[model samples]
Each structure stands twice: as C-alpha cells, then as structure tokens.
Target: MEMQKMSNGSHHEYETLDKGIQPEEESFLPEKTDTGKKIQFNDFEGKTSFGMSAFNLSNAIMGSGILGLSYAMSNTGIVLFLILLTAIALLSSYSVHLLLRSAGVVGIRAYEQLGLRAFGQPGKILAGVIITLHNIGAMSSYLFIVKYELPLVIQAFLGQTSSSGDWFMNGNYLIVIVSVTTILPLALMKHLGYLGYTSGFSLTCMVFFLSSVIYKRFNIPCPLEAFGNFSNNATIPEDTCTAKFFTINQETAYTIPILAFAFVCHPEVLPIYTELYNPTKRRMQGIANVSILGMFVMYLLTAIFGYLTFYANTEAELLHTYSKVDPLDTLILCVRVAVLVAVTLTVPVVLFPIRRALLQLLFPEKAFSWIRHVAIAVCLLFCVNLLVILVPNIRDIFGIIGATTAPCLIFILPGLFYIRIVPIEQEPMSSRPKIQAACFTSMGFLFMTMSLTFIGMDWMSGEKRSGGGH
Candidate 1:
C-alpha cells in the first residue's frame, strides 16, 4: 500500500488508489463496497459536531483584536467605521469561499497543500511563513492582554494598591506563572479537534466581555468622573458621550489595518474543515458563514458600545479604558477577569496554526511526536512572553503584522490560488469567477499599499510628537 502524508504529518494509506483520477473528480470518498458503490468518508465518525466546529472558528476570529475595535471606531467615526467593518466582513467571507472552493476542487485539505499544489515548494513555504507570522502576532496580542490585565485582576482580588512593589504582583511574573500553569498545557495538545471545548469556553468569555461593555455603556457617566481620579492634571472633554458621525484625519488610516487584523482566521479554517465530519465544500462553507457572522455581530456591538461608553476618551485597548475609570468596581473587575481568561484561552487556539505551519516547513517528513510538540509549544510561549513583557505598544505590533501578513493571508493568496487552481478553460477570460478573482487580487494589493502608507504616517507622527516634547 502506498502512503500519503496528511497536513498534520500523519500517513494515510489507500488500497488500489486511482492514479488517473482528474483533479475535479478527486473529492474525498469512503471505501468502495463490493458492488462498487461509493461510500461517504466517515473518518471522524461524527465525533465533532457543527456547533463545535463553529465555536472553534469563532474563537479563532475573535481575539485581542476585538479590544481595539472601539479605538478604530473612534478614529473613523460611527458611520464610516460601521461601513468599513461591514465591507471587510463581506470581503473576508468571500475570500474564505474562494479558499474553500479551491481546496474542494483539488481535494486538498490543508492550506499549505493548496499552496504546494498551486506553486510547488515555494508556494508551500510562503503559506507556512505567512501563517507562522500572522499567528505569532496573534499569540503575542493575547499575551499582551495578559501582561497588562493580569496584574490588575490580581491586584483587584487582593485589594492591593498599584503603588505596592510586591514581586508577586509584577505583570511579567504573573504572565510566566499563567503561561506555565495554564497556557502551556493547552498548547501541547496533539490535535486541533481536542481544543473545541476550550475554544467554546474562550468564546463564552468574549461574549461576557461584550455584555459587560454594553452594560457599562449605560452605567458610566460622560466626561468620566473615573478619568478625573486617574489623571488629575489632564483636561477632560466636556461632551465625551456624544459619538462622532464622520471624521477623517492622519490617524483614520490606521483603523483599516486594525479592522483587517480582526477578521484573520484563514489559517485555522482548513484544519477545522479537515477534522469536520462529512466535510464538504458546502458544509464547511456553512461553518465559515456561521463563524464569521457570529463574530461580526459581536465585534459590531463591542465596538459601538465601547465607543459610545467612552466616546472621545476611548483608548486603543478597551480594558485599559475601564481600568482608568474604576479598576475596583465589581462589574469592571469581572469584565477584566473575563477578558483575561478569554485571551489566555485564545492563545492555544492561535498557536495551533503556527505549530502546524512550522511542522510543514521544517519537519514535513517527520511524524507527529509529543516531544517535539511540547518543546515547540514551550519555546513559542517563552518567546511570546518575552515579547509581551518588552513591547510597550500593542498598536505598533498590530499595525506591522496587520499591514504585512494579514493582507497576504486574507486576500492576496486566496485569490491567486483560486485563479491558478481553476482551469482557464473552466473559467474563461470573460467568466464572472475570473473577473471576480482579478478584482479580489487588486483589492488585496490596494489594502497592502494603504496599510504600509498609514503605518509610515503613524510612525512619522509619533516621531514629531516625541521631538516636540523634547
């Protein structure tokens, strides 16, 4: 029996495989019966349900990025931000459709395999690299949340003041403790399917976070009495509760990339699809739709309520804004804990794609080993913890990763893969699919160019502010 490697480095053997099967007819099939009836593949045996798959994907899509949406809304205003967000959601859903269609047509379940089929080794390597970087950035963001919020949660629980220099209260120490005790164990799991439970819990935490934001929106007063206590010397805006309907400035461009970063679950999509029971293009697409739509509603509500709550004073990270208002408030403390738990749980989900990408690139021939898995998980968490401790600005990290790899994964690669994988004869020159692919590719380029330009502008403006202060 000949063996072929699956995306996760496991071998699958097929008896009497057909070598002459065309790409279009290579759909996944179960073993043939004595009468030659094609039976459906039940490899999973219905272990994973549709709800679990949707929850996993939803957890992947909603991460630390949700915390920044209010800040993005503040930059672009209510009208423009909602419009931009809706457009991005629709575009992201379409891109996923393109990717799944290409994979289904070729019967390739992994993103790297699709890349390998499209452009040989270079394509595979490119996909792996992008996945690694994007997911690393995501993991770092989750750890960043831990770094900043964990300390506050601990202090709230202990009723300790911020002025205390207790070593136990140090953010870095707390992060290390949490990583070793909680995140490391979760990250060491062998299969992505096992994470469905944790993913569901993680998503629940985010939902609580959304609910808390909405509740606080009505509870908090304008010109925030909380901010007065935190910043005694700073001037407070008189009309902080009123939302901005429309606005554009140097900072507005940064919001586009931030929003782009929020919708990136492309790397995790195929892995979930492969493990799905009775996986088909239509079924997987349904999973994608449910996941994206759920996240879209959550993101919108979070952004709108967050922005409305603090309006002019909305900080890049919503938790920070809440901290300044009343760190000791019971509801605020609960929300902080929820956000912290949510991000902690999310770190493992994000790490799966990164580990898989590394295996694909560096250890393609190697079988899945627990030793290697634990070591990689440990090493990655260690490095991300260091980055979280050292990197003071989350926005800068978001900008750089969102500007570069996010676009490539979300837009460019998918469109290019579809164009290359679908036969020219099947999608003729004037075909709508071909035309849409071209338009999608063009949009990816435009997003990449704009993201870079805005990042540069943000950097320059920061330099100017530093120079002026000096």
Candidate 2:
C-alpha cells in the first residue's frame, strides 16, 4: 500500500537450474523429518495472523506492471499465451508453498537465512546477490517507465513537443523528481502498519487503467474487433501480437531465454509469508490462493486490454498505448499518470534490501540511524540514475534485468535451497529435493545462456537496421 520506506532491505532466497530444469512434484510430499526449531520474529508487538494481513503485500506484488502482462502473453499466442500464463502462475504459487515449507522447517524468518540454512554461507550470499540484482533491474525499469510516460502526457496536454533531452523528460532527470516525490514521503513515514488503505488507491488505479481501455475499445463500436477475431487464414499483423510470433519453429529457440526473465518474484513471496504470524495449514493455503488469484486476474486483464488498445500497432515503447488514444481523454490520462506513478514509486521499496545487504556486508558494527538511511538512499538513487541514463529504453532495460538477473531470484536459488536442505533429510524422498533444485539451476543457466545470446543478437540486429540499411 505504501510507496516509500526508509532504511530496510530484505533477502529473498530462490533459485532456478542456472539451465532448463522443472520443479519435480516428488519433493513436496511430506516425509519423516526433524521438527524445526520454533522461530519467531523479535518484533512481535503487532504481529498479524496469516489470514489477517491481506492489507497490501499481495496487492503491492500485484501492481501496475502486471497490467502489461496479458500483452506479453498475447505475443505467445492464445493457446501458448494461456498456457504460459497458467503455468507461470501455478509455478509461482507452488514456489510460495515451497518457501513457506522451507521457513516452517528451518525456523528462518528471512529468505537469506533460509538460503544460509540450506546452502551454507555461499548459498546465502548467492541468494542475496540474485535478489538484489533482480530488484535493481526492476526498480530501474520502473524509473524509466515513469519518467518516460508521465511528462509525455503533460507535454501532449500543453501542445508542445517533448524534448527527450529536457530536464523533465530525461530518464535520469525524471527519476530524481519521481523518486523524491514518491520515495521521500514513504521514507519519512514510520508505522507502516496503517498503510493497508493505500492498496485501495493502487487497486483503484489498476481498475481504472483496465476499464479505460475496455471503454475506449467498446466505444469504437466493435469491442470484439479490438482483438481482430481468431483468423484461420488471414495474414497476421506485423506488430507483436501477430500470430507469426507464436511458433514452435525456429523462433522457439529465441523465446526460452526470455522465459527465465518473465517468471520471477519468488524471493519476495517468503517475506510476506513469514510475516503471517503462526499460520495454520489452512491459513497459509488461503494466503497462497488469494495472492495467486489476484495476480492471475490482474495479469490477464491488463494483458488483454493492452493488446486490444495497441492491437497490431503495439510498439516496444508501451506508453504509446496511452498516447495513441485521444489525448483529451481525461479519464484515460488520469489512469495513465496514477499507474505510472504507482509503478515508479515501487522502485525504492524494492531496492531497500540491496542497500541493507551492502551495509551489513560492509559495516556490521554500526547501528541503523538517520545517517545510514540517508547514505543508502542516496547510493540507491545514484544507481538508479546511472541505469536510467544508460538504458533509455524501458522495455530493453526490463529485458536486461529480467533476463540476466530475474531467473536467479525466481528459479535457481530457491530450487537450490530446497534441495540442499530438506526437512526430511532422513527420508528417501529427501533426494527428490536435490533433483528439483538441480532442475531450477538448469533453468537459470538456460536463461543466462539465452540472455547473452539474444542480447548480443538483438544489439547486432539494431546496429544492422540503423546503419544505412533496411
């Protein structure tokens, strides 16, 4: 619900096959195991039961970025699109269950602790790095989107050309403004307990963003035409949603690498689950169901609306989705600004961990204080600024971060942690966890390989098209 915070970082332990391995179902079945040491948070004064705290963690996790998910799914094709969305959702939910199980058995409150418990010191450090980098990538992308979209709307309203180099439009310049406006409020505030109501604001923005697209498409007098009917023979559109993009043919080789990037957020889930005080089996199940269901619906709605709004003309710069529609559409513009700001503000919240980890690793004896918080905030701002300047294209920025780092957070680290330390180490099924972890590692490795290949190829392709050739 809240956008900003001061002086905090969280480690999320997750892993993928650092190649293409899948989570094996065999590992999840219970086995005779050591009852873990009772673990409890020291700050338990305002502890919330698992069922009690739906406030905004899931809502935060299910944010404006997900609104664009359906469009991404559409690129995969109706069948593959649905399949990928469903598969990723199920896997993501299962990942939460695995994380919860890991915590319950190890008495580890933070995700890093689970990594350390399972994989030794190296494991903990590795997990921390993955989560940190993945989040950094995420935050930077958000900054780019906010800086890029919001000012363009303002300029459009003023009937002035947006200067790409202008102070208001430059990615880094906008980062400073948005970060200060958004993050400063959150950082200055304490008592995050009361922020549940903020999720309502975010939820409203999300709802309006979708409804605007739906309304506009329908008002055009043919809502179904927005999707352009499922054609059996017509040549597909040239833009992303064109049917040609979804093939099991040669292009399939190119897609698997991006899969690693798209399927992440595993690290963030455990912290939310751990905060669920003394959860029962049923309560935990409820949290998982609610979180997953909310995410699924948001992703599906946003993606479909994005595709319809953009249709065959969807550009790599998704801001066009808003710009192409009449600029005078006041409701749509409001929705755009709200969603953009929400996504932008999330950067500081996500980045809180890396700053903390860096501090802990570099200076362990110090107390958390105003000076420390300011220093970390400044450092993170610098990092974000550098990213915004270097990576001007928000989509490409996401690809870099999501492809290069997200897999580490999502699949490889979590999988490795589960396999390395099973609660039922005495049982034969404990071996299954190792296999499952190996699969996750394989997935990560596959992603790394593909990311390098595609990035290199994508870069080369851009060069070829730009230098006096078509």
Candidate 2 per-residue lDDT, tens place, 1-470, comes to 00111233222322332123222322221232245433233233334554334544554455435544444544454467566667766766656666665564443445666766877777667667767776776676666667667776776566676455566655556667767777655643332323444544665666677677677655543223334553556665555334333535433444344333444545545544545555443466576667667756766666665666555444333445455545456776777787775665455445555664555455544555777777777777777777777764555545566666666665666666666555443323446655666776786677677766766777877741100000
Q: How accurate is candidate 1 locally (lDDT)?
A: 0.78
**Which candidate wins on TM-score?**
1
lDDT of candidate model 2 versus the reference: 0.55
Off by over 4 Å in 2: 1-39, 44-55, 63-70, 159-172, 188-195, 221-263, 277-285, 308-311, 317-319, 363-370, 389-398, 429-434, 463-470
What local distance difference test score does each model get?
A: 0.78, 0.55
CA RMSD, predictions in order = 4.9, 8.9
Q: Per-prediction count of colliding residue pairs?
A: 0, 28
What lDDT score goes with residue 11 in model 2?
29
Residue-level lDDT for 450 in candidate 2: 73
